[model samples]
Target: MSTSGKKATATALAQKYAPQIANKTVLITGVSPKSLGATFVTAIAVSSPALLILAGRNAAKVEETTKAIRAAAPHVPVRFLNLDLADRESVRKAAETVLSWEDVPSIDVLVNNACIIGSEYKLIDGCEAHFVVNYLHPFLFTNLLLPKVLAVKGRVVNVASDCHRWHHIRFSDLNFDVSVSWKISQKSAAHLHPKQNGKIYNMWQAYGQSKTANMLFSLALARRLGGRGIVTNSVHPGIIQTNAASHLDPAEIPRLIEQVELQCGLANQEITSYKTVDEGTATHVYAAFEPGLKDHNGAYLLDSHVADPLEDPVAAWGTSEADAEKLWRLSEKLLGENFEW
Candidate 1:
């Protein structure tokens, strides 16, 4: 499909799902202005959800998003909560606060939209920063709030990326401590390669692996929660111009863009295929409320529909029952909390 066609389809899906948001209690993470999360919150607010919780690490940023949503949606109830995904304690406290809410009956939707891209290497609980911020944190938070979500048979929309095509889970050395050097000859193929100077950590590889984790988590969660009436799905929101790339060095942007274009096999090298924030966020909105998706649990969505794993190799790996189960077990070990459900 052409870019314009994709955009139109996304807009139509958003409108189609708008009515489902009314009176639903929705909680979304990562709502900074112009970010995908903010776009989801704004689009959903039009339908006047009963309560909208905007979560992020920065209180001021969350407040700014809240103000914008309120300005556009004066009647919608919007609340902001400080949620630092890198810290396990903060995630726990935030989940506790939501669980303690006296008036809110149930959470209808939980959008794990918060994620980071290129950044210097760091560790949280002995895990890579991208892996923790993008995958583990969401895993912990979602499991923590499972009871509330189950109460309403809610949906969990994980904002994953098609960038998962670049890498798969590095189970042996997830932190890049031992298995650092790697190469992606083509966008679809990536593997470890010995470096002359020893291990060399690459931020892009870390980011790609983290995204793969998102898909794996969604598949595993959906399988586990399937019979419980709760739905879980991951979405590749397409490439979009967002602050997600703010951490990238300015000189690297052009090269990265060119590489992405080449990998996507776009004929016009001069024209990038990035989507506007609205079009990029539409799949997330669609995945969160599409009634037909109830039977499509554990599915990965692209362009607002269930994507074929055969079309994307990384997605195929993510959907592997064995890999998903391994990831789930590893996550439980890392978090020190075994989820019963």
Candidate 2:
């Protein structure tokens, strides 16, 4: 409920505390050998946590990152866990794996730093891929491990984006089943129209919705978990080039970039809005272990400093006391009784 005398955005805080990235026992999801996720992983590699769990879907990239981390600090133990966020079971299994690791019971920090753009409204485990991978999966992943995090009273840093402001999440339509009579997936996703009249929406529309959900989740988590000594905040890691674009329609990527450039007044191919992967990773680092946030809790941070989330995401997502309560219950409902966490 208090600022803890801190004055920095997620980006600024990361820059200020660049030295703390090493040996911090951080778990960065979606990390790769050559991505912003990896860059953040490398930066924090210096902090040298007793253990660093480098996770991603690719075993090869995870191994490459694990090797790089070990080379950077021979004594620091680095482990790898392959997780497919799109699959709920994979996320749950990943939680079990991380919890079972030695020296991991008391986690120091959690960086929900995975995201994507230009991907279609495809379904993963029957939900939109962008929504599931970017928000729902991570939300479940975090709540599942929340006990471990709270046990150590650690920091939670969620990576969010400004694209959240682009569209409002249709919580009612998230399933995309009602519109298609319950048939939704790669095949149906391709045919699922997201626009009426003349416009370009659909695929990225769901993406925008998910990002907003992430921000709202961060806001809600900050409020709900702050009292537990767990400082939870979200960040916009900046628009940097990464493989997240791989799933995006290649031809449309350039067009979207061009539009964003004009709106932001940046030069064509300027890369101004985008930073190096290392730079992008800084915000997450700031959130997880920045000295400034040592006394912080329950605040949404952007770039590294505490910034208001895109408009009122909590309100947009579900601000009603009843709605928030309902969301928790709904989450539990979807997760099933097997997941006692």
Candidate 3:
């Protein structure tokens, strides 16, 4: 169980665990400037890991992050891995490239952190864009790279969120097509509505559904890796200023902010009081190095501690064993491959 209170900062944790980070190879996706992933890598860079592999879709953005890392720690060895989470083939190629890299050691910390946030309805390869990019692709990439992670008995960190409480998986209506989504109800079967009400798709719910999958996927992977000395956990990096929500209309920003505050019980505080990018990166950095988490595999971390279901409603629903297995099967079905491991 986790206690509720102030959280540790990423820089402090990195300094405290410098030796542990020094010998490990870390891979993180979505390392764009001002984003959580970039901040996370920056924090890790100071400690001089064996190798820092930054991955993303844009070469320029990844280069930008690489420059920042160089400035922070010039001697740190950093490499770029071209990864486009929206494209399944790109993910496969990225994983294959990693597995084939003879110069790099086994991945000691695999952080599936890149994600997109928006209200618009779009599809990738006939699946919902949010579902595909946020959950499906990372799911594929992680499983494909399991060999590297397992070789070092490394841990996995899935950047999930508290927003998951806003909606269920919508198993029957994954795309949230207005025509099909309207059919779901609170009275629907467990697979259709896991504690969520019957409602049409909205920007919040769409993002929520994908985030829920992140947590469930963490649980499923942990179960499968039983007794393997590998810890897999999900984290809710606190709300912070980032470009993730750029897809939403500028005018809708305030409304979206207000909604997030209210839903996450921060409505009483001002927007400026939201966590800074470095602060938001704390729990992620903490999760990556915290040795105590080995006994708490499949846990959801928040504010730099394992989240308590009593303190956060999302914890219980996000960790449902049944939901985890269900989402795992569906993910395999969507990818047209069964991961026997």
Candidate 4:
């Protein structure tokens, strides 16, 4: 599809599925005003949820988002919870705070929307920065809050990316310590170099793997919790220009975009194929509340509907039951605790 066509489709989906959360309590992570998470809070608040909890590493940014939501929907209840996804301790503390809310008996919707991309390589909990922050943190946080979600038959919406189609998880060297590199060849397939001299880490590859993990997590969670009435799904929120890309070098962004487009079979060399923040949040909102999705748990949503994982090899890996189970076990090992579902 052309860039303009994609944008139109995104806008239409946002308008068609603007369901309100009503009396449900919703918790969303990554609410910096500059990102799509803030727009998500605004959308949920306008729907008049019972309570809206905004979480982010930056207390000030979370406060900013909360204030705006309150100002717009004064009748809707709003709260801010400080959360740093880079630190497992912070994730646990944040979960504890949510679990301690005496008045809010259940959480009806949990949006794991926070993520980082194209940042300098770092480690958290002895894992790659992107892997920990984008995948492990959410994995732990969601498991910690799973009981509350199950109590309400809640929906878990993970904001994954279509870029996940470009790469699969590197289980052997997830930390990039072996100097591996992934390049999208002209054939639109990812090729890996096990030993690339002077290239310690590839941020784009790490981002893709992290997003693939998000989809796998959703699939695994859905399978584990399906009978319990909780729903989990991952969504490609239509690439949008947001602060999530702030850490990326400006010139590199276009190059990465071009690569993704090629992988997705798009001819657009220009990286302008993106949705507005409002449009980008639509798929997750749809996944969070659309009753039609009740039976579609573990689905990867694109353009506001279930997308076929067979469309890409990396996507297939993400939706693989075996891979999901493997990732779940690895996550438990890394977190040093078994997640009892």
lDDT of 4 by residue, 21-139 (tens): 67888899888985788887776676667898888888888888888888868998888888999988999999999899899789999999999987777877678898998999999
Return whichever of 2 and 4 wins on lDDT: 4
After superposition, candidate 4 runs with Cα above 4 Å error: 1-20, 179-199, 249-252, 259-272, 310-314
* Per-residue C-alpha lDDT of model 2 across residues 172-265, encoded as one tens digit per residue: 4565443333356434543566532212336555666677676666666766777778787667666666777765565466578667545434
Each candidate's clash count: 0, 20, 0, 0
Where model 3 places Cα greater than 4 Å from the true spot, the runs are 1-7, 178-200, 247-254, 257-272
Tens digits of per-residue lDDT for model 3 on 1-341?
A: 12223446677778877887886899999988888999888888989898899999899988988899999999989999999999889999999999999877489999999998864777788777888888899999999999889888898999998778766787766876533434565235445544333244466677888999999998999999957867899999886668686555655666776786576445333444567777788888878988889888999988888888876646456889999999999889888999988
Candidate 4 TM-score, C-alpha based: 0.86
- Per-candidate TM-score against the hidden true structure: 0.88, 0.76, 0.88, 0.86
By TM-score rank, best first, the candidates go 3, 1, 4, 2
Best by TM-score: 3
Could you report the Cα RMSD, in angstroms, for every candidate shown?
4.7, 7.0, 4.5, 5.1
Q: Which ten-residue region of model 3 has the weakest summed lDDT?
A: 190-199
Best to worst by lDDT, what's the order?
3, 1, 4, 2
Q: In model 2, where is the ten-residue run with the lowest total lDDT?
A: 1-10
